[model samples]
Target: MEALEAPPSLAPDNRSVIFTLSIHGREAECSVLREALEQHFWVQPGAGDARILKAFADGRKRITAVAERKLRAHSDEQIVLTSADFEVRT
Candidate 1:
């Protein structure tokens, strides 16, 4: 990410960018959704982190959006999916 290329004077390490998703669905639906996320975004599993399903740069927005749109098709009155960004101290 461009932030990684920033000079130490800019203090890139002072902040972090994170992408997140929250979905409400059955177990089967959740599994399929996870696969869809990996297929559409530049994400890798968050190792042992349970809160983060995947992680990627802001530059991956295009594909992330496309994947979100695709997942919309599977939504119903009971299923919900959403994403948000957070800037936090590193």
Candidate 2:
């Protein structure tokens, strides 16, 4: 991740400095995280995989760790968190 230059209109100060974060090479992880959130928390029952939902019942942290490990093994880029990844590991 890199910080994009702040707009000239926004002046830097001792209190705060504003800048946009430029992220790269992690599209796969972002997609996984979004899918997990939608499937696990935003969807009604019967809308997502039963195994994934069961894994999520274990805890958010466990699910997130599984997702990160899966991504690390598959690619060089950093990963975001997800619940379905826990199901896959189990």
Candidate 3:
């Protein structure tokens, strides 16, 4: 799985859009895109089973509160949004 995942949307400029793509080539055919994804990296969160592994696995990490808003779909593959819906995160 990717360390970070972002849905494509118009960038902060409101004219340009950034896309998140997965590598599709072998070690030789992929270089440019690989470097681009590496340059924008996000650390993975530690999510372990709460019974035992959770405490021991990442006991040192702080758990942040996450507020979730249900995502609605406009189509089978598209999302419904207005100009106010665009959000870019690190």
Task: Tell me, by lDDT, which candidate is best.
Answer: 2
Using alpha carbons, what is the TM-score of model 3?
A: 0.21
- lDDT per residue (tens digit) for residues 1-90 in model 2: 432233211112211111222335343432234345455555343343443344344333444445445555766554444444535542
Worst 10 residues of 2 by lDDT: 8-17
Clashing residue pairs in candidate 1 are none
Please rank every candidate by lDDT, starting with the best. Answer: 2, 1, 3
lDDT of 2: 0.39
TM-score of each: 0.24, 0.29, 0.21
The residue-by-residue lDDT of candidate 1 on 1-90, one tens digit each, is: 111222111113312222333334322121123333343444454422232233333334543343345446654432222332111236
TM-score of 1: 0.24
Tens-place lDDT per residue, model 3, 19-84, is 332222211110111122222222123322232222222311111001012111121232222222
